[model samples]
Target: MSFVLGVISALTAPFLVVVGFIVWDNHWNGTAFALNMYNCTMTAIGFLIVSIVVRQFVLEPSTEEEIFTSQKIGGLMVSSTIGILIGDWVWLEGLRLLGSRKIIVVDSLKPFLAVFLGEVFLDERLERGAIIGLILTVLGVALVGLEKEDHNIETETTIECESVGAAGTEVFNEHTVLIEKDNNEQSSTVVVDSYAQQRKNRGKQSTKEFIYGLVMAILNVVLHTFGVLLTKKYGVGMTTFEINLIRFGFAGICMALLSFSLWSISNISSTTTSTTTTMTTMMTTMTMKPAWYLLPDASYSTWRRISFGVVFVSFLQPALTNYAMFQISLALLLTLESIGPLYSLPLSYILQGNRPTFRACIGAILAVIGIIVLSFKGITES
Candidate 1:
């Protein structure tokens, strides 16, 4: 049941992130920095609460080596925080730009990237199956890109204008044209307005944003690969709960200090607009009730759901995933993680009644085959 829960948690983790960001984006128009900070802070608080409760009831003491005084553990915490912070920020930014589906597909490159990173940094030997898996993973990513391109083509809007007295019709595809009809100026005006509307619709497809998202997605893979390697090397003698508490607690403090500093600067800048008393009140409200002040207004139920989702995703998911990480090699672990989309496909189908596209199905199958081959190699070598 624990293993089953871990697998379920792993499969649904991305969806939870996607849903949280979508809700926040829709309601609060939240920045990635704000969301990341809130998530870290909440996770830290949750871990602290759980730790206090467990300490009161359970008396499992840590060894001297497990104490937090060691320089090695300190370095691990610093490096891990950097990796998690940057990785999560860029990942949310990617989701903002590319949406959940595209970002998730792009994330499939993680295992392939991790394989190379492990070989270089961890002195892990790449087996023949890993090499083959890398090829298939790349191929699968390419197919996903193709699907995106097809989606773009399908979304492209074309306007066909048949002028009243003109000999031929003029067609415009995502571009403006000054069409002057011989007899009907009103008709020409209508065509121009229609073309303007089409342009407005097409403006939503931003090539620059898509490219930025793609780069961020790739950077996330690189950072996460390094993080996993660091954890496998230096995460010895620490409980998962201890790791989460320390890492998130440190990050939460840093983020709080940064937020306060920014708020102070902003208050100083706007001092002329408001009296000192009003400024102090504003600052107090922001500090004492940050979430209520910063986040968008929603119903109590909505806020409750959002809070629950964040706790599950930010705290529980990592705890379960870290357990699985300890049980497998970094390379094999990442290879298995690549099958997340395959799990998501069926889950999405069952829950949302959304069918997978043919290309997505093909990509999922390829990724699964690669994972199976890689896992088989790992077992045989062991």
Candidate 2:
């Protein structure tokens, strides 16, 4: 179950993120703070609702008041803010500065970073065979990531994606907030949300832009790796749902502040000259909410879709991943989880009927072999 769930998480989380951003782009025009505020809100509420169900009716509450002690709670809060909130913003920023391809490739390197740190910080060591397995996994994922050479990757007008994992650190990515054109009014607008709903229209990037993107991408990895390590340190004290409650609940509050700050800034300057200002203000004021529409349309059914990202990808996936890490090593778990495209490829073929390229097929096979070797080596080490 743990391994299966890990596989599911590695595949689904990134794509589901696209879901939450659908309403964001249409309504809020992809404000980073809005994404942050919205993601945190939905994330917290989703965990709260599920946690209540699990706690009240499914599982007994932990009598360990120490779980909620100031020290533990504080640690959890700090970790969550650093890992989820700031880290999330950073990766998306990287995406906007760079592009998804380079950012994703860089993100795929995070497991190795975590593994290296695991040894230095936690004295986590891997067997020789495990080391080889990690190399193979990273290579495979890279092959898959770099398989596409197309510069203009405008997907069919509608697409979906919600993901971040491989999680030696979460590969939180970015789409730089730019001034969005308001169709109702001709005035320029800027990105005011906390999330990157989509990659920017691709074009040649200057050296400085490339450098900035690379730095942000690497920084995003470092922060997320830190968060993952923190989880390994503090994750053992509570149930999965309990950990999630603390993690996302704290994130929601912090994200709200960040989002509100940007949101207020954007609105404060709106000139009363254009009727669109009033319309944008009214639209924002009314629509500033977590996507909760129950409609079945792929994009508009925001909450239903976000549930996949939140409940399965964030909540359950991490639990499974943590369990795998406990059984194996953090390095091994990172290697296995990092091959996200391996899992997503087959699902894409199955669901969308998009055939994989021969290149993709080979990459998937290589990653599978690496995963098997990693698992076997870890089991033997144990």
Candidate 2 per-residue lDDT over residues 181-291, each given as its tens digit: 233432111221112223322345677877888898898888888877776667666656667668777877776665566656655766534888778767875645322
Pairs that clash in candidate 1: none
Q: Which ten residues in a row have the lowest lDDT in candidate 2?
A: 186-195
Tens-digit per-residue lDDT, 66-125, candidate 1? 455577567667655656667666765564455444655666666667667766766666
Misplaced by over 4 Å in model 1 are 1-29, 51-64, 91-109, 130-218, 274-293, 379-382
Q: After superposition, how far is residue 253 of candidate 2 from its true place, in Å?
A: 1.1
Instruction: Look at candidate 1 and tell me the lDDT of residue 61.
Output: 72
| Candidate number of the best TM-score | 2
Give me the overall lDDT of model 2. Answer: 0.56
Model 2 misplacement above 4 A:
1-32, 52-65, 148-203, 261-310, 322-325, 379-382
The TM-score measured for candidate 2 stands at: 0.71
In model 1, the worst 10-residue window by lDDT is: 171-180
Clashes of each: 0, 30
